[model samples]
Target: MKFDKDAWLLEAIRIKYIIPREDGTVWRRKWISADLKSMSREVHLIKQRTHKATQRVYFNLTFKGITKSVLVNRVIALAFLPNPLKLPQVNHIDGDKSHNYLKQPTPELVEKWGEYQLEWSTGRDNEKHAHANGLKTGRGSQNSNAKLTAPQVVEIRASAESPSAIAKQYGVARSTIVNILEGKTWIHV
Candidate 1:
């Protein structure tokens, strides 16, 4: 089936936990345990909050006596859009993970918002898009684990030392030295 290029698509089994409406509101599906005598299946709107560690909005639901936390974006995708192609991931068009909802969009509004806010994508495609849009960091000297600073990379490039000697001097791998010399890792320098 053909869907709007920017439409939200559901993650697998999303319907079992939450319903994302076009209005951008997510409803938690009430789950019932077969063995429990007093379980009700009435769905209710979910109260979302930022996860402390990840700072992403999420809600929790109980299913078969077990509570599961679900991300808001995943809930939204599962509520709208068809996935005949069965792509495995969702892309936020503007690259903002926080823009998952806007005052509860109607299906029409959801489709419209999606035109500028959502798409189905693979993890690789999502990462490439993030990098292209400068939303992702950790490149070059900006990486927390970087052993060399930008100035050091520039000096390494300009140095006349052999790759092996530079590797020893910098306490880096020999391949790193080779890459620096060949304009591979530190291309910006």
Candidate 2:
């Protein structure tokens, strides 16, 4: 049988992260830096332990005790070896890939998979939306948009136009203008 070297390196790297301690202990990790560079599963290189050595690497996964290497090109792989077989895609529910629990899956594996992963801008979602939208990129959203910003009021009044016109130009909602003009949110002009 031949051994795959590249595969061995990858499994070794991931094992350092996912595999439980040899003492049968589990540890929690913050986040796994995504692998931006991945190659074809079949792209195996013959890594000689020495110029003429025969030892090589083969990437494989094992849920419990069953170990075998499978060639498939993917950023992530799942192995369902123990009882109660599962689909082969692991989910980091909390966006923490090191929390490899076959337990409660998250929305990343559910409803909002990629749509909610957009980067956050002002009025955009951030950490607050992390649970509902795993692997989020943007800052959390403000709870509501009922109030006007102080700069918004100044832009409305100190300008040579009506609040409605300025509101349209600024892309802010219209009611925000009323709040600014009424001094309910920011100091009115």
Candidate 3:
């Protein structure tokens, strides 16, 4: 059976949201409870920071004496959105990683924006969304790290020349040429 993370989260954590103040900053308050009623403690938001590599906002939370770093987007999704399909990834519909609130839109907001900001998605859907939003540069020429253009990859694949000869001509590693010929990389092109 598939493990239900939301169900486990509901039993493990009770999250409470504080209304935004005049400055328009929403405050998220987490209440750790031993039982649903009596024993509880409030803790300040800890180590919340934008990840330098992915540029996604995240924070560390302690659960059962173990500290885990979790993305703020996933936390917001877990708190406010429903994932009936149990998709393994949460996509930021607008491609803004810092905008982590997964609240439903008001009628006025819907009329203006037309869609929710977050949704459950498969890994492929998430990748597609990122590429569609220009957040990800896909394989081949579109990728910043791509050494060869699509036409060059095609030429390399069609060439009967040795991998070393092709690599020297393209100024890339022999393994790169070999991989291209072997259909290991640049499969999209």
Per-residue lDDT tens digits for candidate 3, residues 10-112, read 4444533222222112343465445434433443444458889999887665444445566667766766667888888888777878766564346775575
Most TM-score-accurate candidate: 3
Better of 1 and 3 by lDDT: 3
Model 1 — which ten-residue stretch has the worst lDDT? Answer: 3-12
Q: What would the TM-score be for candidate 1 when compared with the true structure?
A: 0.55
Model 3 lDDT-worst window of ten = 17-26
Winner on lDDT (2 vs 3)? 3
lDDT of 1 by residue, 1-189 (tens): 863322221322343444576655676546545554443468788788887766667777554444567667766665665567877777777676766753323567456444545666878787767766777778776788898887888888889989889899999998998887887776544
lDDT of 2 by residue, 1-189 (tens): 776433553554464433333221232232333462332333222221211231221234442233555322112232222213423322333354333233334565446443221121222222334424434422212225434444555657677777778788878877766666676554212
| Candidate 2 TM-score over all chains jointly | 0.21
> Which residue segments of model 2 deviate by more than 4 Å?
1-6, 9-91, 94-98, 105-140, 143-189
- What is the full ranking by TM-score, best candidate first? 3, 1, 2
> In model 3, where do residues sit more than 4 Å from their true spots?
1-8, 14-37, 40-47, 103-113, 144-189
Q: How far off is residue 2 in model 3, in Å?
A: 12
